[model samples]
Target: AAARNQEKRMVADVKRKEQAVAERILENDEYAQVQEEIERQHRAYEKKFQDSLGRHASEERNRQILITKTTDKVDLIDTTGRGVRPFEPSQVTTIRDHSFGLGHNPRKSGKLLDDVIDMVRDKPE
Candidate 1:
């Protein structure tokens, strides 16, 4: 009878240890996920900060820049004197045609669907 009781106690102890270990593993996994989320947010914020700084620098430099869109037509000037002249008509053979007047460059313009719809509706309907 004593031996049986001893075996019962040993089994109970093993089960308790197993439960504790499982709980610890779950907690560790949760902590890892939280840590990864924090790191991703940190990287996003860092990239945003860098982009803002670059824009600010460019804005500052653009103040005194001089640029001419049509070389023979007129001279364009910005603050930094680094303004670029628009290519002549003869040099504009690779012009992009936008279904909507969003602009030639889709990536740079980033016009949304809603904006395009609005523009179309605003046209002579």
Candidate 2:
């Protein structure tokens, strides 16, 4: 009877130790993930701050930062300067000929679904 009791206590002790280790590992992983997310947010905020300062250069990119996108043409405006400093309007550029208003690269889009539909339609009645 004493030997059986000793064996039971040993098993319980092992299980308790394993549970503790698992809990510790899970807690550390959660902490690491939270830290990584915080860093990502910080980086994004930093980029926004830099872009705001640069996009408005000396004369504020000549205040011509109005990006236009219509059915026929799509225009994109950007400052040709980098870093965390304001630049002159000469450093700003525009891309009025972008995309040419044509959507997609015209490459077998949804080919799988079309083929499946074709197979069903070709079945003999």
Candidate 3:
């Protein structure tokens, strides 16, 4: 009877130790899983942030291109207007010279003056 009781006690102790080991293993697994989840979330957030930054950069680049194109068009218009300016002064001089001609006819001079005025009126500001 004494030997049987000793064996039973030893078995109970072993079972308690095994239970403790199993609980420790479970806790370690839970901790590892939690860490993995945290890492995944961090990676996802970083990717999202990078994507947003890239999109903003792209938008800024497009906006800059639009501004440059608009500026170029304005400069081209200004240059075109400058090219047309010399003809205006020459037309005025022609009108003056024609008015002071040696044998000017009133009807012909009036028609010429009218044509010059029309040309000047058709020009943009």
Q: Per-residue lDDT tens digits of candidate 2, residues 15-101?
A: 999999999999999999999999999999999888878745634554333322212122433355564675433223222233223
Candidate 1 residue lDDT tens string, 1-125: 99999999999999999999999999999999999999999999999878868967677545423222222233332445354854333232223235445534343334433344454576685
Per-residue lDDT, model 2, residue 45, is: 100
Best by lDDT: 3
CA lDDT scores, all candidates in order: 0.57, 0.55, 0.61
Q: Summing lDDT over every window of 10 consecutive residues in candidate 1, give the lowest-scoring window.
A: 64-73
Off by over 4 Å in 3: 55-57, 60-125
Report the candidate with higher lDDT, 2 versus 3. Answer: 3
lDDT head-to-head 1 vs 2, winner: 1
Candidate scoring better on lDDT of 1 and 3: 3
Q: What tens digits encode model 3's per-residue C-alpha lDDT throughout 19-96? A: 999999999999999999999999999998788689777787676654443312221223344674533322322233
Evaluation by TM-score, superior candidate among 1 and 3 = 1
- Give the 10-residue window scoring lowest on summed lDDT in candidate 2: 65-74
